[model samples]
Target chain A: MDLTLDRIRLAYPDGDGVLVAVDDVTLTVPSGTTTALLGPSGAGKSSLLAVAGAPLDAPDDAAGAPRAARGPRRRARRAADRAAALRRERIGIVFQQPQLVASLTVLEQLELMSHLRGRPAASRRAHALALLDAVGVADRADRRPEHLSGGQRQRVAIARALMNDPQVLLVDEPTSALDHERGVQVVELVVRLARELDAAALLVTHDEATLDPVAARVHLADGRLVEAPAAV
Target chain B: MFLALRDLRHARGRFALMITVVALITFLVAFLAALTAGLGRASTSAVTELPVDRLAFAPPAEGASPTFTESEVTPHQQEAWADVPGVGAAEPLGVATVRASGESTAAVTAFGVRPGSGLVPGTGDGGADVSAGTVVLSRGAADALGADVGDQVGAGPLDLTVAAVADAEADFAHTPVVWVSLDDWQAVGARGDAAAGDAQDGPTATVVALRFGDDPPTADALAATDAELGTVTATPREARSAISSFTAENLSLTLMQVFLLAISALVVGAFFTVWTIQRAGDVAVLRALGASTRYLLRDAIGQAGVVLGVGVGLGTALAAGAGLLAARVMPVVVDVSTTLVPAVVLVALGGLGAVLAVTRVARVDPHAALAAR
Candidate 1:
């Protein structure tokens, strides 16, 4: 499935007026491709990615559009419920810090996707183990996130994001805490996983050097998309 | 419960502490309940376990509750109650606490009943042959005076022989009871002036014990009869309040139990509130990952249930054991109402507190998970 952000507009409350984080932006990431959202700090790349993952009451047919469109109270609630279900079943989110539950092991982190969808985690053990093997972290499956290295944790997060075979994978600064070499390797793994899973992956990162493995790139500045140089 | 179970196991120390707190509170409540019931039995068993269904007392001043300490019923009042519809037998019963000397000196409540009145505990079999100078001693009264059947005991102004020591135990106002003839009681009470042809009208007793037929009078009918007879009537159980110490003692203990329950609920709520706040970030992440509000609430409340279950179970067991041991030295009735009821109430109130605390789960913004924290 393709991830389309059609004329998306995201705003937040400022001192007196609204600060538009994503200004009528339209973007698409076709299936089986990695589209890197490159931008500096406060460029609204993370905001746009968040909107794509689960848009907040958006009128346009953005990714995860509002389901209810009539009554304000019920509509907002229904929309949030719909968006959460969308994120659970179809969209896998990978945050900057791995966002792993401290009590869960690396293997259970991936299996959580199945559990969140109300399925038994044991039923998906083989698949979870296979994903860990694919991510080259099978040896560390039973270890908590604190015991794993930064790159390994990021790999685990990526594997977890793919646990449900999501059509859209949204990742935000997954390599911020890693060194230069480890950061490139993590991004490369994300790109490879996207291709293998046929997921429309939108990765948010300010480090343009890690775009070697990503197929397409789009830059955002001042909450508006700009043309980017071709990937290596 | 996937996350909830793991959370509990991961933080066993914290959860254990919480369980201990719940258990201690449950223990206090359960033990207090048992003690309260036991003390209540000691204070009012004689009046409550009476063979008669009701008792009639000289009506108190308007707006005042009846009291055995002040009630004085005459033979005329007993005759009036016997005439009321649905009445079976109305017997005059006099109650007086006095010091008696047998092998030892002890305080005993002297119960005065007419010969063949069938009011004594063992009198169900055509009544004990209690004569004017003889008394039937309850087992408690026997124990206190260290006296046996055929032993002579001095009570009030009369010296009486123990005709028989009744097998049943009865107490009135925390003192053992001794049954005696009504004539002997009146003589010991210095009401013999009437028998001596003095100006006093007649003899009097504390209250009239009224036994009813199978088809008893309704409340309204009883009230009407009471008004006509110039007396107040109450069922034996209801008459317990007339024992001055019972009402105050029961109220104080019950209030303690109620306050402890409230404290346990507040403590559980406060613990859960702080816990939910600490895990607000994790909750946001889960919401973002598609866990519904209802699901999270269920998980958190289930966690509280586990803690309360283990705690209350352990506490009740502890209380039962302690209560049994305490029963050896003091009155402590360990039973279902004292143990299980308090435990269930604790879990319910504690769960309420936890539910209120974890409601913050619904308000946690999923967008917060996007930030570094």
Candidate 2:
């Protein structure tokens, strides 16, 4: 498994009590495969995805399950004091709303992935341009996000996620804002790109229409895994 | 600077307004510093320009500080100072303000010095020819009196010759100085002080000017000498306090400048506080993308540096130009102490404010960026 979640639990503060968002949920995604986490609103699908994207040290009160420790930036062998370095070098994220920086152009957005890791932009421009071409937005490389359409922005985001050739991809409701056709197209793009890059991909969403292209489907209900992830 | 520069370009309007505020604050601070120095020079230049190491004043009343107004150094005190070890030159310096008549009449401070005393303006270079009945007017005094060299000027019932118009500026209590011989000075003083019925044949100089040839007197020696001669001795800088209005005015203006500096720091800090809060979302996003706390701080502070550099640089240029123009009609000096020191201080203080505001970047949780917003 390129990614694993071993009985992870997450909670947020409620009015004088704790509200468990994710309860002992374990899941995995093998490399070169796309897995879909399907659930309704408030079912902790996003919460689970966040955990898989960047695992944390289990709290003292959490259920006695083994926690996966992410490594810190400076020391590779030591467990991460934070997930910042892990996210920068190995994990790519596709946020629900594209989340492209307003100041950066589409191409620069992809280049920023390398820049975040202290790589010079000149050293990554060719690869960034190729990623844009693969996502079919090479023509819009110089245009800012404000100038792009919703579909175009999503495409740019997908290209950005693959810029650093990440080992794991965490995408959250990328199609919630699109219509059926554009939504299917984004899903197909993610699935194809995951296979092309040979990376483990987790897609978190409640929409049932976008599940056909996913190679594995995991059912979640009320912050708990309802059934084991069924691979097609 | 990657994201910082882009943010500046994208939010040009907001950043420009911030820069303008910084510029205005810098201008106020720099201009005030120049004015403070200018006023200080105007207040103390007369005493400071005297070519002597120490000034000896007759011991004051029990609790009062030494002052030229109440000081009355006698010939005995002058002779005693000359007898002390390391005392190079001791001379009587009589100071008094009286009216001068040239093409027009004007008020002037008269400085009484003997022949070849070298305390009079232009005497060191043979420029001023001081005679018993001739006076050498400083540049300011000459301008005020409207008198030139060789003109006959009436100085209170005594017609005196203007030996030479010396290019020197010494203003005592806002009055310019005119150098005159000691004989003419006493002759002028006997009539001037005759109203009190204490005008007699005596040494009437206000203070004794001292110059130490080798090692100057230590604080202990100065105090011992003061005790022995029955006089108060102080350096020229210390004597500035003796000018009636100088201490009060200098203290008040210096305090105001200090307050202005503090206010400038607060203004910059407040501005950056708001700016950082507005960009907190961006900061979180960057943090989530693996940017270190150090990187984010560098970006924020780099942005501030750009703003402060341009704003302060421009404001300093404006103040310097204004100071030059104001010098024609006012006592405005444009020097390193007046201009560059203020500029450096403003930038440093403004940077401090910016740092205070942006340090919040370190505390922002990267998890907030992933939260559903």
Candidate 3:
């Protein structure tokens, strides 16, 4: 499925006013394509990724101001519920750290996504095993996160993200903890899996060296998209 | 309970330690509860098991409390209570702690009542009555004195033969009871000086036992009669407090049991509070994965219930076994109320404590998981 963020904007409260995080950001990533969002630290790359993944509330119609409706209260409860449902149904998020639940094994971690979506674990076993095989860690399916290496853990996390067949896959600095070679290989694997699974992939990273594997790249500065780079 | 079950399996050492703590607390709670019930029974079974509905004692002095030890009822008070409307039968009952001997000597509560009265079990039949020098011993009293029917036993100042043993077992103030006639009791208690003054005024019966029909005496009428006659009337169960030693001993043991229960709850709360804090990161991750607050709460409480159930079950079993063993050597009585009630209470209170602790999961911020914090 294709994901389109039409004029999406986000902001946070500053000392005396509000600071824009994603300024009128309009972007689209069609199925089977990998888009890397790159910028310096504090460039609003994470904010844009967060907005796309439905983790943060959408920006207000007002310019350079945070939407005042996102605070926790009875009035904003319906909006929060809708946002939560969106995340549950159509979004898959991978954090900078593996973020693997330590108690679950590799296979169970993947199965948990299906379980969250209301599928029985027994019925999802074959699919979970298949995803584990696709991620090239099927042999370690029964091992917990503590038993796996950093690269292997990230692979299991990737498999878990795809377990629900989410429409949009959001990657947040997934290679931040890896070496140069390992980071490059992880990025390549994400690109390959995104294409194979026909997912609209958004890769957010500060490491510019890993952008070579992405099909397209976007740059953001000071909460606004500076320019849209050509497709690779 | 997907994550909950996995956590239990993965953190076996930590959960095992928690379960052990719960087990020990449950063991103490169940044992104390059983002991409390057993001791209460040993102290009050004689009065509680009586056929009469109420007992009347002599009224205390101004600003004083009425006690079985200090209260003595006169024949006039007994007659007044007997003549009260709706009072079917009223019998004089005397209770005194005295030394009784057969082959060996032991302290026993001598209960003085009329032979034909319903108060003494197996007395209306061909069973020998307590005449001048005869007494009926309860099975427990017989066991304590190592004496049987046709054996001789000695009370305060008189030697009496054990005519027949009563079938029902009753105890008062942790002492076996020996049933004797009211005349014999008065003879034994009368002082040489008091007996010489007025034959009816020497130490009278300790209390008056009353039986009520379907239409029984009202509490107001009973109080009025007691006020007019200078006496106190109480239902059989309410009269337990009149036994000063039983009341004090029971309160202390019961207070300890209550304290133990409170400590169990606090221990459970503290343990789960730390467990929830340790897993705050995992909770945030689950929240970010679209797990609702309700779902997480159910999972946490269900996990706690599993632990409590297992721990309480094992502890109750151990308590029952220990109670059975203790019954042989002590005044312990192992029954369903003493064992099962405590197990159920421990699990319920432990679960409540756990729920209080795991509610912190609702406050965890999903954004923290994104920060790798």
Candidate 4:
């Protein structure tokens, strides 16, 4: 399924005032395509991604402003439950850091996703191994994150996110810790995997150098989405 | 258990340390349980092993409790007990501690009864005649005296022959008992009391052992008889506390065992509480990755179960071995109450502590996993 973030809003309060993190933000990533959310830090890139990936109750409390209603209170609860279920089965997320479980081996990390989805581990072994191979870390399948290099860990994390063949892939600054050359290569790998798997990919990043493989770039200045590049 | 098992293997040193603590606590609890049981046996077996349902004693002064050491039931009190409605059998139980000399000499609690009162250790097995001069010795008494039937032993200047050794084991105040005739007991105790210038005039004994029939008299009837005769009666179990020093000693050991059990649970709670706090971040990541609260709790409890089972199992085995060794030189009874009960309790309470600790997994904010560290 395609991911649609219709005119959603997120705001925080600042000294007797509301600071909008996202304002009427509307965007979409169709199947088999990629959408790159890029901006400077504090531009609400992460907050907007949170709204799309894990829908929560809009903040309307001290130090925060009201968010656009996803629906009624009961409906919103159902929606959040629906969203959680979707995340388990259809959405894949990659945080800025590798964040691979310290105890899980490379292959086990991906298999864990299938296990969470209630799939038999034995049945997913070959698939987990194949995903690791696709990310160029097949030989390191038996090794834990402690022994792997930073780039290798990121590769494993990427493979783990894709283990369930998600419809929407959310990438958050996956190359922030890698060297310039390696960063470019990691983004390229993500782009290639998204296209090969036909997943609607949303890549959040601040590095301009890594935008070569990102098909569409949506910029956020202060919680509001700027128009797509004129190249569109 | 996927995460639980791996976490244990990855952090073997930490888990092993916790397991050792659990093992030692289990060992302490099990060992103390055995000791309490053994002491209880030594203190009250002589009374508990009696065939009667209850023992009747002359009431103490206005507020004092009934005690075997101070109780003295006369022939009149025995006749009153036997005459009570629903009284199946009432036999006088005369008890006295005196030094006896045989192949091996030791202090023995001499039990005095009628020749055919059927209170002797091996009554049906032709134990001892309990006539004027012969006495039946319990296994422990015989063991201490090193005497067989026809062997002679003397008690307080009174000579008697050991008629037979019975398989029963009886003790009072940690001393084995020797069954003798009421006449013989009166002769011996009478001499001692006379020599001490406090001899009683008539036949007197310690207490009257009673057994109730199928249609036993109600409590009201028993109370009326007691009021009329000015006596008190207690079930075998209640009478056990009347044994000198039995209550205080048993209470202390039991209290210690209870404290050990409570301490083990608290220690387990403290350890897991810290463990859970230490891994809160990992828990957040797991929850963020779609692992449900049930899954996390199961994993944690499974980890605790492994720790408790292995630890308690090891500890019980050690305690059993220790009990076997201790039994030879000291009073220690190793049985299910000492081993299995403690092991089960350790696991249950340890699991409870773990549940209290890991429930925090339910409140972990999956959103935190997205925060920049």
lDDT of candidate 1 over B125-155, digit per residue (tens): 7545678899899888998899998899999
In order, the candidates keep a fraction of the true contacts of 0.53, 0.35, 0.40, 0.21
Clashing pairs in 2: A70-A80, A71-A80, A72-A80
Interface RMSD of each: 4.1, 4.2, 4.5, 3.5
DockQ of candidate 3 relative to the true structure: 0.37
State residue A171's C-alpha deviation in candidate 3, in Å. 0.7
Every model's TM-score: 0.93, 0.91, 0.92, 0.91
- Tens digit per residue, CA lDDT, model 2, A1-232: 3888899988887799999999999888998899998988888888887777673432323322335433232232122225777877888888777878888888888878787788876579999999888878999999999999999999998888888889999988999889999999999999999998999999988887877888688888879988754547
Which candidate number would show the highest TM-score if scored against the true structure?
Answer: 1
List model 4 lDDT by residue over A17-48, tens digit each: 98887899889998888888988898889888
Off by over 4 Å in 4: A12-20, A55-83, A227-232, B187-203
- On lDDT, the leading prediction is 1
Which lDDT tens digits does candidate 4 get at residues B102-177? 9989999999888888888778666555888888898889899899889998987689998888788799889999
Where does candidate 3 chain B have its weakest 10-residue lDDT segment?
Answer: B188-197
Q: Encode model 3's per-residue lDDT on B27-94: one tens digit a residue.
A: 88778877887888788888888888889888787886678888777777888888999999989988
TM-score-better candidate, 1 vs 4: 1
TM-scores of chain A, one for each prediction: 0.89, 0.86, 0.87, 0.85
DockQ of 4: 0.32
What is the C-alpha DockQ of each candidate?
A: 0.44, 0.33, 0.37, 0.32
